[model samples]
Target: MDWTGWIERWGEPGVLAVAGLLVGLGFGFFAQRSRFCLRGAVIEFWHGRFADKLAVWLLAFSSAVVLVQALVVAGGLDVSTARQLSARGSLSGALVGGLIFGVGMVLTRGCASRLLVLSAQGNLRALLSGLVFAVVAQAALGGVLAPLREAISGWWVVEGGPSRSLLALFGVGPWDGLAFGALWLVVAVFFAHHSGWGFWKWAGGIGTGVMVALAWFATYQVMSHSFEPVQIQGLTFSGPSAEWLMRVLSEPGKPWTFGLGLMPGVFLGSMLGAALGREFKVETFGPGYSLPRYVTGAVLMGFGSMLAGGCAVGAGMTGGAIFAVTAWLTLGGMWLGGGLADRLIDGRHA
Candidate 1:
């Protein structure tokens, strides 16, 4: 409750970075342990199977929604100033970008966060893809691809505030959101049971979701306590990837921030998780894998994430937990795109 000591010890940026690190660590550890991945869920759904992957994804998503909504309803958290709600957004960008990202994930066989986790677990393929993803994301953010991203994003704009808040647009109260989350939680639990998930699987999924809520809460707390302004945010990979990339390449002395800490935290946490699970092993691309395919997917994901304003965990679970309009639209587009991609690409191969 008392942030004074922390502020005095580490200052605003340090404290914020530490918060991000803690949240990222939790997310990475749990996600790695649970094998939480939207791509797997998407693949399962497209294949017409309700299985453990879907159950894990649902558990993570619903847990985030339930906790976040409960905090808001209880006056324990105020998300009004969060960038997902207060910043201007683009519906066209969300739709198009999400679709591209979904396709890219299928091609790469992993989403942005999943790639990071896999990389830490010593997957050379994922390491290469993640590096490409970061480069592309950086290019999209302010480099060569910025112009194209801006052009697409400018197609349909929505002002900040209520316009971006799905809860406001739908005339739903926080209590209603809480109830909806609870319903989904029940569904997730049912599926988990049906799939015969062990304790670690289910618990890890829930922990991954809890980290999202904690990210929001932690950032909010930092913003509320600091004299310097801070952006309230949750678990997101796109912006952080870009930020980390820039920090490494150009800004050695860049001020410490939440995103700066989050990237490394995830890597360290995932490494720890892999080590603990005895899953850490150096893996390179096999003869069956194509370097060109991963390169192409990484390029698409990089550009798409920038245009969409987030990646899967970013816009999907994090933004969806708070009922952001663009986030939901982005999520819908991802499902549509993932299904189509799976059917067209993987299906043919199968």
Candidate 2:
């Protein structure tokens, strides 16, 4: 298919909006059905239970890599368009930011993306959490915390040479990237089978990964072909949350971008899924848990995600799939941060 030509011919604002909705619906359905969540998956892995969730996550990551590679080879998409996929800084920020994000999620009981999905399912606490996260993220991106983030990011420089994809770093040609990606996929599948997760769960996990890749393809195609072409981006949660807020406040004057539209579409699609499944449940801050905890978690997540430059969906699954070094850093940081929180909570309980 001549994707470029097709998009040029018919990729109007309305068509792009429809494409965004489709992407959102696909993601919501897959996430809801598979219960795919990075923080939750990491926590389960830490506890040595629900190992299946981790497998699912890895499978999704691997799937995205494969799909992205195919798109690149076919000349339909370029991985570099997505900010997270760029060969950027080293492990410091991603690791630290991810750790903070992970710990915050534990304290709050869900990651940023999970909070969005849960909120759609009627979790008022998550709604509150999402709001706090949006505010803090905006603040960090351009508010009080902006200076700190900029200073830290500026300090770190990619050593040895300019940023390059993992495949390039290893001295492999274009095809090598695909081969390496497939290796990860094979490993994920093998681990899943050995971990005692049923075949159905494993399949669900793989399906979730494919869905993520599809989201990238959908967005890339829609945006590239739109009347106003934008840099290619993919499934991320943090920045978009804040952007959505800004757009809502600054309506037609702001002129809705694909990123802005996609964020809300995901939320709406998830809500529809919950309503259809009869799984929506309204929840709020329970007794004894002060508002401070909720606020703190949100703030930490917002700042952490901003510094890290993406959330779990952005860095861990989406960026990781594309072999971005920053994504790995974020994943490491998120896990460490979560582990730290777990330790602190455990000590307090003890």
Candidate 3:
């Protein structure tokens, strides 16, 4: 089904990037409209409310798993090449790095994805933080911090051993994708009806879940069929943000690909969504000097997401969809970290 051969009669390299942009736009739009923040979702539970945000996230995750499984059953996609399930994934890194990212998001008041949406609404704080995040993430990934990160990660990244996926652990193959997906589907259905949920929230969860699957499909099939195939991947923010910056500064004319295109799409789509929602406003730093706080937090998040291999949307939602143990470990670390930070913030205000 070499799509590139069929489509290349009139095809372009930017096709993958363009697909990423369109999908990313929808992801950003829904994220903003639904106020989807995993930190807020988790902190809410600690505040004694029913963690509606968490439930919504589960819906997205479970739904993603189900869809991915469908692709496996149909022999339409492969998750092995995805970073979340790859050998480079480290249990130790996922725990430590995810904890750092979680706490950082709590302080910054958003994750990388949220930062983009918040910036669209004129939050200068988010804008600054996002910039710091991109720079630091790039550094951690392949710049000054790369050596240290490699050192820390090499110690624990499983080498030639059973992979971290449950299916892999049990010596299973693609059918496990479907089994795992169905498992999450049930979890999503169980939390379908929560009090105080609006129509848009439900829609956002389902829509985001579908979008994640679309990401998998688009990259796996479309890119595979292209003149140049890309490593199959789903939605992720941290590393791509850095890649976007590098592309802008050094390779503005470079052809678009799935990840690079997705970054700007999320940013642009968030702005459109904010404007439509009438939530667009020129905002500045909150009470008393919080600029430094966000910068510091952004630094932590930059390194953290890179170390953990993904952020909330990447690891928490997308990776968790396939029941990746690494995603769960990192997600658990994020919740614990976010809870701790929320309590500290509460203590200060109390």
Candidate 4:
């Protein structure tokens, strides 16, 4: 649709970048306040800990699902061009990529988003890992590793299959977002029943979910109303991190992008959170040889997230409610990999 001209007309680099920064800042603030990491939340629940964190996670995702669906229905947003919308990435890629990303998150002790927040909080170790992750992700997107990524994705494309949510199989509805959201909310409420998280923590979690949906709505507004259409993407960290890094190297003269705004916002917001909590401290790897683990994990995450098409934040929670094939497949793979990491890590200490 001659998006280039549209970008020129409406996507004033400054405005778009600022919009992205605001969205990112909202996400970072809420996430930090809530301590929201899907990996940690799910794993904590798995360990027989109370499901407060799990409830928080589910509530956020389900809430986002409800709002995102409603926004699309209201015609306030259109996501036809989003990465999550394609629904045709290679299943094989999802499997391998999801698993690898999960394992990497375990090694690094956090996901891509978590690493960025940590980096901002003065974790030099996290900064290094985050850089490696962004650089490697860049390779998969269009650098030396692009050919390999393309080849793998081409090999296992989920061609000719319905890309809609599992609910479609029931034939009762198609993208019945309200019903879908209701079901998730019900589940979340049920879990929340026993959770001990105070009202404020729960609010933070719910706020995070709303922000996720708001990201979609905000980006959609920009894409639909402007004479020029920007890519209709929502919040995600993996590729955006790389995009920002690559731009710094190649397009140093250009201002930050809308998508790129989230990375720095998350970092800065997290730093602010830490400072407020008196938890801000420069952290580094201690003796006992931690560098290899972090490096390997970062590399795996970089490639795996690219291969799987999204991380937990991008695919598991955001794409998850949509019933996208990649969402389910990636989460499934992440579960397997995360479980494996749990066992390996436990055994190492044992």
lDDT of each: 0.91, 0.72, 0.78, 0.75
Native-to-model Cα distance after best TM-score fit, residue 163 in candidate 3, in Å: 1.6
Q: In model 3, how many backbone clashes occur? A: 3
* Candidate 1 lDDT over residue span 63-154, tens digit each: 99999999999988898888889999999999999999999998898999999999999999999999999999999999999999999999
Per-residue lDDT value at 70 in model 3 = 84
* Candidate 1: regions farther than 4 A off: 348-350
Which residue pairs collide in model 4, if any?
6-228
- Highest lDDT among the candidates is held by which one? 1
Worst 10 residues of 3 by lDDT: 5-14
Model 3 lDDT tens row, 1-350:
45676457635456677778988898888777767778777776677665567666766777777887788778887777676676557888888889899889988988888898898889889999999999999999989998877876767765423467767787786677677667766765566565455765777777777788888888887756765556777888987899888987794667667888898888887888788889999888767648878898899899989888888888877777665778888889888888888788645433
lDDT of 1 at 101: 95
lDDT of 2 at 204: 52
* Candidate with the larger TM-score of 2 and 4: 4
Ranking by lDDT: 1, 3, 4, 2
Best by TM-score: 1
Worst 10 residues of 1 by lDDT: 341-350
Model 1 root-mean-square deviation:
1.1
User: Each prediction's TM-score against the native?
Assistant: 0.98, 0.87, 0.90, 0.88
User: All candidates: CA RMSD in angstroms?
Assistant: 1.1, 3.1, 2.6, 3.6
Tell me the tens digit of each residue's lDDT in model 2 across 256-283: 4555656667788677768766888887
Misplaced by over 4 Å in model 3 are 5-12, 160-162, 171-192, 348-350
lDDT for predicted candidate 2 compared with the true structure: 0.72
